[model samples]
Target: MVGKFTVVDGHVHTFASEEVSGKILTSFNKLYNIEFANPGTGTITDVLQNMDSVGIDFTIMANFAPAKIIHKNNSWSIEVGKKYEKLVPLVSFHPDMEEPMDILMEEYMRNGAKGIKFHPMAQGFDPDDNRLESVYKMSAEAAFPIVFHCGRVSNARLNNYADIDMIVPVIKKYPNIPFVLTHMADGNIGDVFKLADMFENVYFDTSIVITGYPPLLKVNEPSWPDNEVVEYVISKVGADRVIFGSDYPWGSPGHDLNRFMEMRIEDRQKSMILGENAIKIFKIKSSI
Candidate 1:
């Protein structure tokens, strides 16, 4: 365990090849000039090694659909997750794709995918579009969590769609589905944290929280996140709703955990943020 806490990174991605230009690797290059030789060190094998070194027990192998490769990427995640018991694969699809609800239903029945992730800006859709109703309802029925890219990034064209305001209505509509707002709203974190206070099912992930934010945050230029904002959010939403996530390969999970651990809070709270919250939300079974 990482300093007496059983660790789990709730948000991480897999790259079958360095040529696959998804945000998982692109963000790393854009934020830091460090390059991978290929997917050799960023694929499932790489994740396993990193977890072993840093004391991470398991990770959720998240997915993001990049329009052209929706099916191939989803299948890759499912198959990789099967290869390793530590990786929990998430089903993903573009909201605007044809018959996505049917696809998700079939994938779940066939593969037993328990959770899903979405990148609204990457997929080119409104975050709260009505077209997602059937899929959201299906996930709600299963009590599956939906991890949404609720913040802007360097590669996205329309930055406005990931705003928390646009998706609050949708979050309200689906109470059963544990809706996780990723990247702490990507710098609009304070506002996003307030939303957590309003919804019981709402949760927040500290993935890129340690790195750069818009208007000036950079991966090469590291900045300590505002402790005041974090303390305030924890006070407002309580530590139970916050989960630890290292946008693996893009940022360090250990760094993210250390950021929270350095905060002046009770140890119990830190433990929840590190792993308990994710285990409870994702229903992660003990890998030990």
Candidate 2:
């Protein structure tokens, strides 16, 4: 875990709200007053410090900008990107906004955004909706990967296959846009594997899926072992398409770091899970 080999957390969040003032963990912990100081969310400094402690090199962090704050958050992320080399800023779109697809292509793409993060459940839109087709097309044109929040598999709040199936035609239509399905496409991972096989532009990141519990505690059962799930994803999608993601803030970074250390995956596979896969997928050249 020393030398140039360490974990790279791909998905992280910064609560850059006026209420929190971008102090990630401290503000959240203060709000909750938890003694452990390990509630997933952390300030940028906290995140960086935790990474150093755990041998994590970088964390690709993103912030949410609803319609009103979209411009400001985007600006803040750009400035934050300038300040923190380890924090790779990501752009997000809430389909509810006016002409969000057009805005993403024309304005935000020109900004320092490396990718697009969409949450259908939070945003209240179907991935397969005809309106989002234009947005997907714009992503293809921009060559920016779309990191989507895939819903659950069974008795889930969002139907996994149904939500993603809506976008199958888009994958077929835009064969070159790099689309990354996070969290192993919720629970219906087999269907996500099919998408990866069917679409050359698609990739899936192994995030909170490998981590044991929390938020998805009821969902992440004992039967779903980390080694088994990671092995299955690598087998189906190949090592290259599978990238590492801690899902920090919302996900348990410390617990996941421990689990990753404990997992039986080989050193080479672990390297792929940590950072190598992301290098290939995101075309990120230099190490952090």
Candidate 3:
């Protein structure tokens, strides 16, 4: 535990330099206004370093794989997840990929994946695709939570795939599937709150919302989801459903933790957002 709280970073990405698509890299550049060499951003070693520094006890890490590279990315993620006790593996899948169902099943049933992650912007797909129905159904049956990249990228066109309107059917139909909306649906925070109100299984994470740079960098750029928005999300959704996530490299866990701590929320609420909610929702068997 991080002092008085059980800190869990509920969202994180781990990909080889080659696996990050140009589009995803470009989007990251736009969000942070920095020309990032995708590979320069920390790797497993960096992730561990940052988590240790920030007092993050655990982190839920996922792989972002497109249709053509799911196998490679998933295999790589399994290797990394197995090596780190603090890193909880959240596997990936592609609806168009051959044998995706089989891969998904094996990842969970054999590899011990704690959850699933879908990055429509990075992987190129729509969150509302009918093809995902079977996947959702399967997850619902297993009671496995899927944290989807909700909302659009900063300068990308595939954002429609994560549209809040499109999220309705997938979420409504699969009541049992715990859906953690990533990026707070991008900018559609209002609609996100509605979904949370409609479905108990719906959840939100604070990652790459305001800023991505660590407090040390102090990039001096405008924060996207500013304090007002953060306050609105917290007051409206309450703390139990808000998960702590730093889109590391893309966003800093250290900065994100500091930002959340500065908010005018209660300590108990902060504790839940830090980790307890994630543990309960994701069924993590962490001692914290």
Highest TM-score model number: 3
Worst 10 residues of 1 by lDDT: 213-222
Model 1 collision count: 2
Query: All candidates' TM-scores?
Result: 0.84, 0.79, 0.85
TM-score rank order: 3, 1, 2
Task: lDDT for model 1, please.
Answer: 0.71
Query: Native-vs-model 2 lDDT?
Result: 0.64
Tens-place lDDT per residue, model 3, 193-284, is 77778999888887766554544134323235467677777889888888888776667777677777787888999899999988887777
For residues 78-150, could you state the per-residue lDDT of candidate 2 as single tens digits?
6777687777777766555665567655666565667777666545566666766676777777687777766
Which candidate gets the maximum lDDT versus the true structure?
Answer: 3
| Predicted candidate 1 versus true structure: per-residue lDDT over 1-288, tens digit per residue | 778888888888777865654545555455534433222245666788888877888798777776567777778888887778788888776665664666656676468565888877656777677777777888788788999877565433355676676778888899998988887666465576568767889888877664322322343222335777677767777888887787776666655666666788888987888888888878777755
Candidate with the larger TM-score of 1 and 3: 3
